[model samples]
Target: MGGLRNLSGLDASQLVIDGDLKISGNNNLESIADLNGVVITGTCMIANNPLCVGCTCGSIGLAAFTTSTTTTSTTSTTTVTTTTSTSTTSTTTRNPAYEGDVLCQSSAQLADAAALLEDRLRINGMVAFSNYDSFTCDVDATTLASMTAISHVEALEIRGSTALETLAGLEALAAVEFDVAIRGNAALSNLSGLDTLSSIGLDLTIRGNALLTSLSGLSSLTHVGGQLAIQSNPVLETLDFMTSLGSVDFLLISNNPLLTEVDALASLTSVNTLYVFGNDELANVNALRNVTIVGDCFISGLKDCVSPDACSCSDL
Candidate 1:
């Protein structure tokens, strides 16, 4: 069964094919309904079949095919009361929607999930990729580009992507209504892909990115409706790129080992709660001269300072 082009007339529901089963490049094939109870030995290569959805290979047993039988019953009364029942015992069955989290490990699976998200957003105005209310991506840069079509995600997280050097191709995403987190991405060095994002309705967190050197990509971000925290980035040396940000409900800058200057936040004037701690090289809070309406302020661990007055502050 190698190069036949079409299988429209083949109607075998239960089949046993020995050796490797290779079905590829079937352009006209849409459904594999006839191969429902089929069994194949060795490997299964089912690719380049564009129209296939929810295709599964039956389980392998001993050295032959094992098929399960299902039964159905229907009863009707004189008043037209009908009852139907179905019972089956199968080795492999398709899971229903209420099973659990939908795992999307491969790019193809992610594409399918993205399409479903797009559909849900069109009908419902918002979508959470899972029960957790966030769309999580652990894919490479190429696969991440494929996600640019998604625009209505409530929350987003990009982590564990080794090949992501820049956040490019996500130009369509302009808002995150909840939270946005970029963490634990070793090769991610820039946030240029998020230049279009101007606001975050909740916390904005950037942490645990080992190779990130700067926050220049976030230059367009003007407002953070909730807390703004930048912590644990090893080589992020400055916050000069976040100059446009003017206000936040809370602010924190901690544990960024090489961050020495923060004049980028010169425009920021108001914060309800503020904390600046554990930044080894942050000599003073001079960059916060414009901050006049702080509800609460906590400052510690500035290497070049001895007291609150020594931190170029007349009051705390």
Candidate 2:
């Protein structure tokens, strides 16, 4: 027992107990066969082992000697040590997912999703860096705040965001480009104060917001470089603000089931492609005299025009 500490025959991976062992060392193992943290493969055969005398069949083959582990005294008190260095100097911190970043995806990962350009994006540049140049936020019906606190986005596409309740704060956008597609927000009801937008460089698509009843928000977009489609917003009884739009190359307003009058569309002068169909209550095509677009004008429900306009749909 005296020369056993200096024997240097201990294996860290596998320990074999051949003798009837008595554990004594507080931090060392006099006999590791008595420990519980270690695993025993063969029939521990507690019935045959010497330590388990009165234990029942429940503790039949195994035993726990967690209390008996004691430390052994060595000639030198240098304990075991790990070799790997514990340095954390070069590790980098990562950014968490949040609002106001270009290209946000739910399941399908996006490409070129550059991290927040600068942390303090609101104060640095005139152009909204929190701006979305080319991206789609096809969120689930549960993520309704898809329109919250949207301070600066260059181009935003909202598709299949079904639980969107309101189109609020979009009136505050001063300069948004590319496309602002609010499609499939089925629960959207109101677009109250969106007349402040003065300049747009691309298309503006507002489709399938079922409960929207007014065209009051889009009264200020004076320049659109591409198409403008507002379709399937049912119960929208009036297009009273279409006269304020400055220019549109292609204008489409279709599938509104209950639209009655489009008095404001008579003032549109810059449209190059005009289409109004699927609206059951519409009974006049006289207001389409000013359109100069290049596509089919499917004015299928049009009637009762005192002066038939120069459109190729009816005037041809």
Candidate 3:
């Protein structure tokens, strides 16, 4: 079934398809959870159904398909064949999951690092790179650009890279299963490379980047499962790129001296703890007036803005 504009459900669970299975371009399609037990003998194609959630063939327990690009978006495609079988046996071919940690500390290891990430699409452990005072080796954006095959990692830490100016290489990263910390990268300017990242399973901390000026790369972020902290980025000026962010657990916006407004938090409707303080230039926080917070809040250092009492759940 392809291009069926109103097709919203496919209950083919435990069914066997002898021919190629194609489900694509259904504009109103939403759920494919029922297709989890499907067995396809021929190739499978499921793509471009804008409203479909968790629609990937691999996500539904079918064999992983060969695709040039992989993203968390609904517009994903999969195509691969399976052998004919008489029994009701099933197997899932998931992307390779690396069990060991990956660390790329220098330029000499960049090629090896890229090759390792290219083969392991999912890393079950941490991926870290620390270039605090390494004058002998350089790990810049160009070094990270080679590792595009990595789609998911348990944790990611990039710290103190003087040569790293932008996150232009991590474009293929879609999700972080744990925390993500980017700190003390003095030359780093913006988050322009994390454009496709949609969710974070835990905390996200951006701290002490000397020249960083914007959060422009996180435009696709929709859900942050834990704390969202942006602190001590002296020149960081706005939260504007976080327009797509809808919910987070603890929201901490502290010490970003140049940050003047949080108007982009208008899309934020769900949060637990809210701590906005030490931002000397912060004046406009009218956006927090409509946010729904279920826990405590501590807000200060603003000249003329709504009080935390105004955002109390009791008022709602």
Candidate 4:
């Protein structure tokens, strides 16, 4: 059998492969720029090709290859190319379930990130802010506009944005297919930008945002497919923002020194597991008056919180 030196047959705009692609040890190959439109329904593997350069293998969108993959080049200096041109890219082919996580370290890379997010209707992996933790520049309207334009994402995490005062840029964000965790932003004051977010397909955790005093922006959220947690904000006064929320498997609210009430979560009716602790000002759980079922309950550390009759269920 002649080793494949040219992939002329696979160089079509609508190429489709029903099974895995395992191409390796080719000494004559040069570039995979021609296999741009190829779609493999299974896994892909390309390794030990001495002359092969660039991220042609990864240029094929990970969504096309639905299974695990690996790519090893001869020079050992791996670079990723994108289907659509973008300054930021990630090398993927390891796990089938995820295409790759995109990291945007600066505002200059926001365009690349927007391009990546705009490549498809949904992203199978993560889009993160790497340099936000210590960013000195403002997370401007243009940056937030790009981030908010993304309607479907697997996971969205923002950490340590010291100067961010609000989620004003993320106003258009409506859905997170998986988790949304916001932590360590010292200047963030409210959930004002996520005003349109109505659903989270998985967990939602808000922690360590020191200046955050309200959840007023999450007023539209009505469903959570997994857990809901709010913790460690010293001045947060209410859970009134999530008034529309009704379903969650687990609930956790803890460590807020000024949070005196949870009356905002009055709409929640189901929780399989719940833990409420560490808020010194919280006096009662009158908000859980509609909660009729709980599998396990852990409530302690709130000096004035009296056990309400609504949580008097058989399981806990």
Candidate 5:
């Protein structure tokens, strides 16, 4: 059965399926624990159920089964395929190994790279791509859209792509286990693709993108475990999208020539070290009125500013 949008759970304790059993596209299904005694002799396919947080065959405590199944739970957006043999002695869960860094320097390699990432869901290493010298290749929107299935990565870097205008393909990317650096992508104007990214395990650096105008796509980002540096972007004008960011280990906003004010940082409550400098158009930092710094605070190069010993300043 599929497309049962309102069905929350299954409670058939003694259910048995002689043929294939497909349970899919159930948006609100949360538990299948009551199906613990279910017996299935054929393939069992469960996919696209968004709210099934931990509803797995093992989690359901299946009494007896002999079949192969591929389960894709949207809770974490990861796919797991398991095979149960007739011997009942062992159940082998197969997780394909797609390890190491992925580099796509040319357009020719983008399709294969995207396909590999889409199939694997997550990667153990970095994903870096740049069209620095390749006049025939560009990491554009379509190329990034093909990688929609990638939800997590150890690290990600998109740099120096002249034809890349926007980050429109990474809507499903929810987290970065480590750093995420977007730098020197000359034609890149806005971060529109990372709308769902809520956390970065380590640093996040946005630097030297010649045409970047705003931090628009990071509205869901709340935490940066390490540094959060926004530097040297000549045209970057605002941090308005950072309303959800509350804290970070270090916060640095420097050399953004057109940044006039930091009103977007009003939600920032904590930081280890805070540095705001070299922003030519910036006149005041009154927006940092409530930030509490545990380590150090340095403010300079604004039109008007005052150093507060305790890291709170309302008059700039």
Candidate 6:
């Protein structure tokens, strides 16, 4: 349309401005606010004062908006989930809900969502933070610190954040039922600071931590209301803290070589399937000998199942 400014101040619903609004002749056309949703065409090069909401300028070169309601939370803890080594296809899985009171979104289109978060999260509907779970960003542990501007979210899936190296800003999340998946972040080192994350009453996944040497810091991760699967963490040598666990159904930990001595596993008598595979260093399958193996006992890599007085792996 020739006149892009025709819809200005128009209460017309679903008004869409296709092209960039420019004052061709007026040199004194001070910056203006749309006071309504406006879509821009092509790249827009406007000063901070000229930008408007819903301004879909091409590629967003340099634009800033300041509203008193723009909530900014500072980073308090600097923790990161471990990395993964193998190629695995992601499956569709729904986990528990909010670990705290508010859920923050990094890409707030409405611009003032934080102000309504407390209100929308009244009964059940979660305030969509960042609208992120639907897409993936190439962020790693080292860069997670820069996402401090990201607001609170009840549940988050940065699993596809290839460049994500840190799990910092998440300590502020106080929700009870949360599902966190940071699977594919290759450079993440340790889950040390995630000690605060134990408060998560539901499922938690720190899987794919290929270089993770130990799980000592996660000793606090004992009481999960649901399943806990930490598969393919090959370097996780010790599981010292898991003895405190009261219940678990599918406790899958495969391909972890250094993780020997699961005697501490007695705590999880409630688990139905205890998959311990590809663990070469595991010599004693006896720690699990006493427990009633209701399901398959995948202690295959062991040199041999301990001989119980001559039965040679008796079927008890």
Compared with the true structure, what per-residue lDDT tens digits does model 1 show for residues 1-316? 3344445565454565655555556555566556544444334445455454433344222112222233355555566666654422222221111111234544456666553332111111232222122434455555556545444345666666667788875666667677777877888887878877788889888888889997867888888999899999999888878988988988989998888878898888888888888889877777787786557788777777755433633443
- Report how far residue 283 has shifted in candidate 3, in Å: 0.3
Per-prediction TM-score, please?
0.59, 0.52, 0.65, 0.62, 0.65, 0.48
Q: How many pairs of residues collide in each model?
A: 1, 10, 0, 4, 1, 28
Poorly placed runs, candidate 4 (over 4 Å): 1-100, 105-111, 114-121, 131-141, 306-316
- Model 4 lDDT per residue over 41-128, tens place: 4456665565666534465555433333443333323367424322212233422322567667776776776555442434567767
- Which sequence of candidate numbers ranks them by TM-score, best first? 5, 3, 4, 1, 2, 6
Judged by whole-model lDDT over C-alpha atoms, candidate 4 comes out at: 0.68
Pick the winner on TM-score between candidates 4 and 6. 4
Top model by lDDT, which number?
A: 3
Q: Which stretches of candidate 3 lie over 4 Å from their true place?
A: 1-96, 105-111, 133-138, 304-316
**Where does the lowest 10-residue lDDT sum fall in candidate 4?**
86-95
Backbone clash pairs for candidate 1 read 167-193
lDDT per residue as tens, model 2, 1-316: 3222221344523553432223222222123322332222222221222232342212222232111222233343336853443311111111111233344554343222322322211211222111122534444323322233233456656555545455453545555656667666666665544556666577888887777777667777677778888788878877776666656877787888877777776666666777777877766655566656565556666444344443236662
Expressed as tens digits, the lDDT of each residue in 66-112 for candidate 5 is 23454333323336865543311222221222467877877788887
Misplaced by over 4 Å in model 2 are 1-101, 107-152, 293-296, 303-316
4 or 5, greater by TM-score: 5
lDDT of each: 0.63, 0.50, 0.75, 0.68, 0.73, 0.44
Query: What is the clash count of model 6?
Result: 28
Worst 10 residues of 6 by lDDT: 88-97
Sort by lDDT, best first.
3, 5, 4, 1, 2, 6
**What local lDDT score does residue 80 receive in model 1, on the 0 to 100 scale?**
61
Model 6 earns a TM-score of 0.48
